[model samples]
Target: MPELPEVETVKRSLERLITGSAITDVNVLFPKVVKSHTPGDFKASLAGCKIKSLARRGKYLLVHLSGDKTLVIHLRMTGRLVYLEEKDDLPRYAHVIFYLEGGKRLVFADMRKFGHINLIPTAQLKNMPELKKLGPEPLGKEFTVQYLQQELRKRRTKIKALLLDQTFVAGLGNIYADEALHLAKIHPERTAQGLTGSEAAGLHHAIIKVLEQGIKNRGTSFSDYVDGEGNIGTNQYQLKAYQREGEPCSNCGTIIERKKVAGRSSFFCPQCQSSKR
Candidate 1:
């Protein structure tokens, strides 16, 4: 699953590639991928619409189109978007292809078939069930330290689990959550409400720092993730704790360990994040 940084990278790349290009036609080979509207309606609604901009909220990609419609994509697990010339062969998993003007095509390929596409009126996007319930974007101005502290203080769930909750802080997934917690030196199993003021502040800073670094490095590409241009992300090489189990911690030389928390693998340095209470 691509987290915030990966999604944001895709957004940026797609913005550069497809913005202002008109959708000449839409082919939905996998009807299930069209979540909101019927396949016929989805194709009809998108045909000839020009892409205005691309943005991301939480883990969803927002493709703003002409005439006030927004195409929302959730690239669950194995979805990949690539732009290719019409003469190029479509990838084997290509499920949705947006035929654009000037002989170009934007393809959505998902091997796992778990990804979804929704078309909603731009005005109604904010009230849609998917976007409406999402919490503030972690990098956005609304996600302040005081906001994080207030949200965390209300939860008795383990700090790791709380961080994974989308309503608590949007755009954090297992990989980034582990990285952020390790950087903050906070144990994954610590109760959220038990965090001291300093710990909360540290965590707030760590989350932003790791996410910004991840974006700068393109994003962690541990699986089938790639940018719109089919390039791998560089952030995977910079990871410190996630997937570094039994390796030396970069800061204190403590052995990095992995444990299951809330049914997800969490990586941390035991010596660095020892229970402080």
Candidate 2:
């Protein structure tokens, strides 16, 4: 899945490419992809509206448009949103296409078909169930070390699982969760409340560090992710723990290992991230 950094990168790219451009038409090839309004209503709402700006909340991309409508897009897993010239052939998996006034196209493609687009009143965005329950952005001011400590102390869930909960930290997925835990030297199976003050601080810093680095690299492109300009990200090369199982640890000489934590594959160095609390 494209997490916070990938979605944020797409938001930045689309903001540059399509801001102020009017939507001439909208094509919903897969009607079910329109999760909120009917496909007809969705098309009518967006056509002729100018894209005011782009923003990302958690893993969701917000397309602020004229006429007070905002298109909230979630690129769940195996979803790709790319900007292309009208002269280019459409991608086979493109489920939604927005035709811009300047002979450009913004395409939303998903192989798994789990991606969704929701058109909602911008004023009601705060009350929208999808956006309402999301926790503070990891990079935002609200996600302080004290905040993380408090949240962690309140949960008995496995550290990895708690981090993956959108309502807990917002935007952490399997890859980044494992990376943050590895960086903080916290075992994935450890209970959330088991961490010491120093461990919580380390985890907080690790979360911010990895996310900033991911955005700097334009996000990890292990699968279907791409920026708005159709470029794959390079963060995959910088990964330390996510998919490096059996390799020597970047910090310690011990071999990295992988196991299921809360039903998700988690990678860590046994020597660096001890199971003891």
Instruction: Estimate, for each residue in 1-277, the C-alpha lDDT of model 1 and write its tens digit.
Output: 6899999998887788889999998989999999888878999999989999998999999999999999999997889888887678998799999999999999999999999999999999989987888999999999999998988889999999988989888899999999999899999999999999889999999999999998998888998999988889999999989999999999999999999999999999998887675
Residue 217 alpha-carbon offset, candidate 2, angstroms: 0.7
Candidate 1 collision pairs? none
Superposed model 2: Cα runs more than 4 Å off: none
TM-score of each: 0.97, 0.98
RMSD of each: 1.1, 0.8
The 10-residue segment with the lowest total lDDT in model 2: 37-46
Candidate 2 colliding pairs, count:
0
Over 4 Å off, model 1:
none
lDDT of candidate 2 over 102-135, digit per residue (tens): 7899999999999999999999999999889999
Please state the error at residue 66 of candidate 2 in Å: 0.4
